[model samples]
Each structure stands twice: as C-alpha cells, then as structure tokens.
Target: MKEYIDLFNRLPNLIILEDEPLARYTGFRTGGPSTVLIPTEESSFVEAYRTIINNHIPFFVLGNGSNVLALDEGFDGVVLVTKRALNHISVDETTITSGSGISLSELCRVALNHDLTGLEFAYGIPGTIGGAVYMNAGAYGSEICNVLNKVVYLDENGNYREKNLSELDLSYRHSIFQAQKNWIILSASFSLEKGDHDTILGKMNELLNRRIEKQPLDYPSCGSTFKRPVGSYASKLIDECGLKGFSIGGAAVSEKHAGFVINKNKATTSDILELCHYVQHIVKDATGFDLELEIEFLK
Candidate 1:
C-alpha cells in the first residue's frame, strides 16, 4: 500500500483519492469505493499509467463508466479515469480525431456541427469513444468500425503506438483490444463525409427520440444488459418468457424494455448479478438460446 501511494504521489497535478465511492462514476449508480486516480493532463496520464505498469499493480482504465458494473466489494486496485484528461476533439476537413474519453453523444454533436453525417447512429449511446471503439459499438445498422480510420494506444510495455482500422479486427461488439488486455486506448480518428447540417441533425434527433421512447431511460442501467443473439433479439426472448418487470431485490427487468436490467431502487451488485444469471438460465431453458451479457462485470 505504501509503494502504491508513493508511486501515485510522484505524478503531480493529479487527483488521487483513497476509497472513492465508485457508484457516482458508473451508469448503474451502485458500487463501493476504490482507489481512484484522475489525471487532468495528457502528460500526467502517460506518467501515471507508466508508473502503475512499472509497479506491477492491478489497474483498470475507465472511460465514461457507461458499460461496466463494479462489484459491491469494489475494485482493490487503481481506477484510472481517462475521461477528463483525454477529452479533446479536433476536425481536419471531413475527418475527426478525438481523445478516447469523449462521450459518443458529445462526438455526435461535434459531427453534426461539422456537417458530418456518419455518426448519427451513435447519438444516444452512453459510452466514451475508447469503450465504443473497443466494443465496436453499433446501432441502427451501423458500427464504429465503419468510420474508424486509426487508433492510438499504449502497448503492454507502456510504449505509445498507432494502428490502422484494418488492424483492429472490429466486428459485432468485439475488437482486438479485448484480446490485448494490456493495450490502452488513447485516441481515435474517424473518416466521414460532408453532408447537410440540418439533415444530419434531423437523423440524430430521430435516433435519440427512438431511444427515449423505446428504452427505459428514466431508470439507472448499463444500457442493454444482454447482447442480441444470432438471428433473434434478446429482448423478445425475455419478454416471451414473461420476465418483464421481474424484481430481484432492487434490480428489476425493465417493464418498458425487456433487454435492460435496471436499478429500480437501491440495488446491490449481488442483486444485479443474480438477476442476470436467472434471466440467462430461464432464457436458455425455454428457448435453447444462451444469452450473453453485454455489460462488463468488474470484480
């Protein structure tokens, strides 16, 4: 513990907190405290990451905390927040380069302002650019891989590097980043085409409205709980099994959207995990389709 604190203190101009409550950082709003480090500058981020790697300490690179569920016991390592430090966005003609911490919604607004049309599908997706690229986030028949040109990342040895879109192996909510656990996403570049600003904004607004109407946005959730299975929707299967509005503790299957598991009250991590496993078992037993979770469970 002394070694960890000493290393953390070496990086100046960084927000270091001990046993910081994690629920405030995540979308589900239910988790315990963790040792968190928030770097406000790019140089500090690099220094902090390098120091953590050198010390052989366990750590998690967190973005907007949109698609993760931290356990009730909480993480026992460094939780590095990249959102505040790496949030810059620059436009070069029709191409957009953004820091990994920028939110999808914010990126969409930037694209619309620049008269770019390809990112309308991601307007309402609640995740950072880094997490979206890592998961190949998609909606409305389009994915981030379609527009990604290249990405900057930190290798296992704490060396900075870049990879083209073709090297990312992006497909169906999977990316090379999953396999390369040590590689940390830093920034990404997207190639888009110019379009009428009003047209782009109109499409973005339509998608946002669709999400607001169809999804249970009023409640706290990690977006869609389960991924869409091959040739069928996960929501339809759960709805068919009559699991909608099923409550286990404070966690409940959303009444509005069967695909979501929401924190309807003061839910615990155990409650959510139990509810997920229950849904998976019931769905598999009834339909013979094994439901896979989309949210990453952080223990």
Candidate 2:
C-alpha cells in the first residue's frame, strides 16, 4: 500500500489525499476523515484500479455521494472519487450517452436542451448516472429502465464490456449490481423521444416545482429513506403509524414528507440510522410491513 501511494504520487493523472474528511465530499455532510482519497481522470481510472489490485489494497468507487451514509469513523480503505473527473455527456437526436460520474440532473438538462422528452421526470433527482443505473432509480412513474438502452461497465475481472437493459434485471430500486460484486459501471446509453423544446421544458419545470413544493429540500438528507413496498407507499405506512416528525438525536422524519429522514441540525450518521430503524420497527409493528432502506450505508 505504501508503494502504491508512492506510485500514485508519481502519476500525474491521479490526485491522492490522506486523512481527508468524507463529510465534505458527501451530500449528507456527516462523516469523519477517510484514510486515503484518490480522484482519477478518465485516462488514469483503469490504471488506478490496476495499481490497487497489484498492491492488494481495498478500494471503493464513489460518485456524487448522494445516496450514502458514511460512518463518523469514516472509511479506513481507499476512497475513489469519480465525480467531476469522469463527467462527460453527449447527445444525438433521441439518444443520450453519459459517463458514470455525470449527474442525473445534468443529463436531464442535456436532454431538455436537445429537445428530448423521456428524461424530464428525473429533472430534480440528485446523484450520478452510475448511481441511478445501479439502483434503477425512478420518480413520477418513470425509471432509468424506461430510458436505458444498455450500460458499459468494468466487469468483476476489470474487463470493459456492455450489456443490454433486459439483461440487467432492473426492478423496484434494485439492479444486477445489487447481487453482483466487483463490477463498476462506466457509462450508459439512454433512448429518449423527440419532443418540442417548449413542451420538454414545461415538463421539467413541473417536476422540479413539484419536488420543491413537496420535499424537504431545505435540509440535508439521503432523499427517500425507504423504498415503496408492493402496492403501498412507505411514507403512507410510516405516517399511519405517526412516525412523521419523529426524532432520534439530530435526525428527524421530515415534517413535510414522512418518507424522508433529514439532518434537522448537525445530525450524525448514527442518528439517521437510529431514526430509520425506529421507523422500520414502528411501521412493522403497527402494519406488519417491513420497510426496506433505500439509503446505502458506508463505513
């Protein structure tokens, strides 16, 4: 690992940092310092992985950092940040191609600019392309699966390849990535439909406006805390159990939306986890429904 650090110091395309705060990098703004941080450029990403493999060092890929809850102890292993560095977007008529690190909101805007209509439903979602594809993220009855044609990824063996949408097994906030280990999404192709620019912009505005009006956007959160159960909404279940506005330390279920657990003020990762567990337990006890977490816990 020391030799790998030395090698990284010599590599121009990679920037390495030690004892860096994971909080500053994540959307939640709530973790301690990480042992090592590496931001690699497109030309250096594969090489960076090779170096980690050769050195037998544990490493994890991170994008936008929106859907994660990093512990206060932080990550002890190597943290690979792919945001900004891998952000690339290209659009051609009804197709949009984006790098894994590209933000979903940015991709939606790109589609809007190109007069593409299918992505308007995702206009206000925060997170990167790879994160969206991995979770098969959805909103307003539209999902990544609806527009995804195929995805290009680095397989478990670190070989580059592509797969069709049908092969991904995308379903209700889950994808093949959930079961498959060691694979990293590199990019994806999305198929959209052509529409009038004004109409596309109108739809985008409507979705964004709805999100702002209904969600607690003023506070920090990992968005929705739980996935919707079959034929039921998690928020409705929690609300029926009177979990809304419930607090655990600094974390609280949003007064505005029962689905979200927000950092009301200086909330710790522990607080969020506690609130999530409480909600799950209460909802299960009251309604016999097991609420599955949508947020990814990172430690």
- The candidate that wins on lDDT is 1
Q: Which residue pairs clash within candidate 2?
A: none
lDDT of each: 0.92, 0.84
Task: Put down candidate 2 lDDT per residue, 228-253, tens digits, no spaces.
Answer: 99878998998899988999999999
What digit string (tens of lDDT, one per residue) describes model 1 on residues 83-192?
Answer: 98899999999999999999999999999988998999999999999999988999999999999999999998899999999999999999999899789999999999
Error of 2 at 189 (Å): 0.6
Candidate 1 — which residues are off by over 4 angstroms? none
Please tell me which predicted candidate would have the highest TM-score against the true structure.
Answer: 1
